[model samples]
Target: MGESVAWVAVDWGTSNVRAWGVSADGGIVASARSEAGMARLTPEAYPAALDLLLTDMAIPAGAPLEVLICGMAGARQGWREAPYLEVPAELGGLALSAVEPLGTRPGLSARIQPGVCHKGVGSEDVMRGEETQLLGLSRLLPGFSGLAVLPGTHCKWAELDGRRLTRFGSAMTGEVFEALAQHTVLRHSLAGDVVESEREAGFDDGVEAALARPERLLSSLFRVRTGALLSGKSPSWCRGFLSGLLIGTEIAGFRNWGGDEEVPLIGSTALCALYGRGLAAIGRKSRIVDATDCTLAGLRAARELL
Candidate 1:
């Protein structure tokens, strides 16, 4: 059996759901993951899906379990919508205004934390899961103040003034890469994954190309095919080049948001490492934070508010 639970923490996203059983002092007791994410379930199906996740956990029967959740589960189309908290707002207040859905399990007291939104002059963006990571950022770097980036399907760049999330922006880097690689003519050149040994060289070339002429991105992508067909470039190299080109452009675009030569990147090791390399390309460095640890810490931090 797992360690006796104090509360449960969940990060439910579009494609997967991860839950952790936590001790009172913020230690993890148990953890589980499932493919039953928001995209696969209706509003009425969330509790059952969540129940299936918890079926094997070690929790006392008939005792209330405080389940704190973050991510797409709180989106407008998820189980129940938790309206976003506007930016320039305090991250600590996330749990205070959390929404509790009616008809959850008899012994489950579930609260879904709201996402953050930035409605500034010409910049409008919203984030769900990343806000929790930002909340956990406080514990990782106390009194931290600078730029923080989370790379994923839609990469986010957020600025923190001490503990408050000031302003943020999103880049559709991963999504765009998927579209270009799978649905467009660029597919021919990107048919295979980048070989580990070849990635660095191809990626560096793409970064340099994009940095030199960011405006010519559309035309440059065409070269991926032409280079493969004419110059006989390999599919692996072409894939790496395309990835680097997209990510490099994203970094170049967001560098002015005060990267300050060092940024905090929190996400999967693979993605964060890629972003770290991209940051290095632009003469900036980054610190990586494991997404799971941040989510647990953020959930614990939020629970304290109750």
Candidate 2:
């Protein structure tokens, strides 16, 4: 029954949970979302949170609904620990490693897919949600190879050889931006909303400054405040400048990892667009993949294997 419900897919992150009703043909029939993410819930609370999200769905009675999930829900502090599979792992193998959470509701089966762990690299890193998205990307571009950059709170740059993930590195760019804008002196420099053109210009300028002289990152950050005071730059410009500087520095480091090729950027549309700009600044190209589509495809891919 291609038109009937086949299963459910959930991307449960730290701040939000989004679910999709997938049909037998892999198309999404319905969807739901909630703010009860892993960061704010205890293990005991996971079931209720999920129940609240699924209560209004149109799944048929007595149907065997398989709920496949990815992201922080599999973390040690999340719903249940889905131990990470080490790198050089095949993207399609995630389904075999899925772990079922205890205390799930009756008549509803759920499996949380494990994230990937990379050790012998730049940083001892772990990624839960992104691995699933990468799986989706693999399905989207069959036999694809190269780097996939997923930008967000903790940006990840993963190198893929075919469907196998070779190695990866992460950057705390987004988190750092939030910290600087809220806790540091830079907050004063980035105070208000900016026009679209001014934001883009400020962002581009920051990218150029960071790439041209990365060693002076700290000093350049301070210049945001100084520029605001002396040059009378608006807060929006300062904010855009700060964003570009952080993102550009991150890209400058990663662009040289492989070659200056078209990298696949996956994440939220806005964040991916931001990373795309930063990539272009480094003479690199990027293809944006909608984060939700990747997550859904990844979940469906895992479900099919099961």
Candidate 3:
């Protein structure tokens, strides 16, 4: 057998699958991806899709694949079912049982990291794969203890106590936004692109409107469509207005839940900016970090245990 030269790291989500070939020191050597996301696969089809990717990449047949995966790939419908680790647990200490691929080729082995569950006052939330990034962030910013916001289909507001994820709350913000923008009556009242100036103005207005009466969020949201139809408000501006309203509602909810005084937002640049803008309008402070970096760092951290 030839000497091992690469490691495989995967970030498998609902709609897409991303794989990276990394050097022993963690530099990405090459990468390949496919549409074989959890959303599009059946339990019986996952192993074949994974094998195709690895084989196409020419990953050595017996190099001890050294796989570390995260995201919905570990969920009930993905490769294998991994349980959730409850809160107040050391991120690095969590583990998942070894997962052996069916119809395995020579020398292929894998492991899937489990998700996390946090139970707090009046709230219970869960996350898969994100915990690794949080662990990576904690490692990068040692002694960092504050709120970390990860925005996606299900946005997570995690309370970090050192390298441990103590508690967190989940909001179906992105999914809700997508559904309202495309599948509902609200779609007819919004424009394609939202401008920066309008986003800022709308965001401020939204923060004020939401904070004035948090319970009236859904009713206030309908006003976007009503105002556009009845008063001839520009659809583009109304789109931005709707964006602001949703963000504003999130900010208000977080504020009510406490912990905004010293929170740092972590996600893609665009998402971080939007969240930061909305929070700033509410007179709260926030810092943004690159989501990709954290994911890579987290993948590397997970490999260490192997």
Candidate 4:
């Protein structure tokens, strides 16, 4: 690679696209982002969106670009699908090379990283892009072992043995919350916003209810609505109650299936706080790490092998 060639990092998920230009030492020299996410574009439009981003970011044509992308953009429906490397493989084993257009430019090169998958005991789960974050976490928290939770639309509970991803599970907590708040009968019982104090108060209650009977999760969710309408609880508090219930249930279910006690949460600050409060309510402690940094750190780690 030429000394002046610019290395690029991308974290393209279902809802967002982010890119950064990095120096040899991995310092971000420039960055850009957009909403042209995987869900919004057809296969043919993928190259167009990338072109626009590069143009908007003023990445000059003819400048050699080495790109590493993570997230859903590597899924079957996204740019291209990357195959999962089974457990016991090093992070480097996750690498896959595929060419993508550089905007409208010809002869440009781009590469997408594959997600990870696990199957066992009649259950299986997969994660796109988050595996990169897990690798980043491994580097950031050297010698760290046990479970790391990446919470978002699809929550990822990853088991790490050193730098390797041993196993993982996914929870659709965020999506479920969105559907309940917008489309379900429970919508009437929740407020426009979730109050932190109320979430704190009901955090443990939610976790407890979830762990009490795993099969009764649906019925327990209905109780949140009933508690609001019949018992005269504030709609806002009810929202918090519902939040606690779902998150708690996730925590409880994972714990039942062997989630580690001391977990590292990787996500936004707000989600991390919510998770922290829920864990506290359940008498568990956790460490919080920034998902964005993890994304960049992961891309940087992957670039080292290029």
Report the lDDT tens digits of candidate 3 across residue range 203-274.
Answer: 567667877777898898888888788987666667777777777787778875435455567777787787
Give the least accurate 10-residue stretch of model 3, judged by summed lDDT.
94-103
Task: Give me the runs in candidate 3 sitting further than 4 Å from their true place.
Answer: 1-4, 95-103, 119-122, 192-194, 256-262
lDDT of 2 by residue, 250-278 (tens): 88787666565578999888889999998
In order of TM-score, best first, we have: 1, 2, 4, 3
Tens digits of per-residue lDDT for model 4, 240-277: 77788888888877774335457789998888888887
- Candidate 3's error at 205, in angstroms? 1.7
Best by TM-score: 1
RMSD of 3: 2.6
- lDDT to native, each model: 0.85, 0.85, 0.75, 0.76
Q: How high is the lDDT of residue 108 in model 2?
A: 83
After the best TM-score superposition of candidate 4, give how far the Cα of residue 272 lies from its true spot, in angstroms: 1.5
What would the TM-scores of all predictions be? 0.95, 0.94, 0.90, 0.90
Which pairs in model 1 have colliding backbones? none
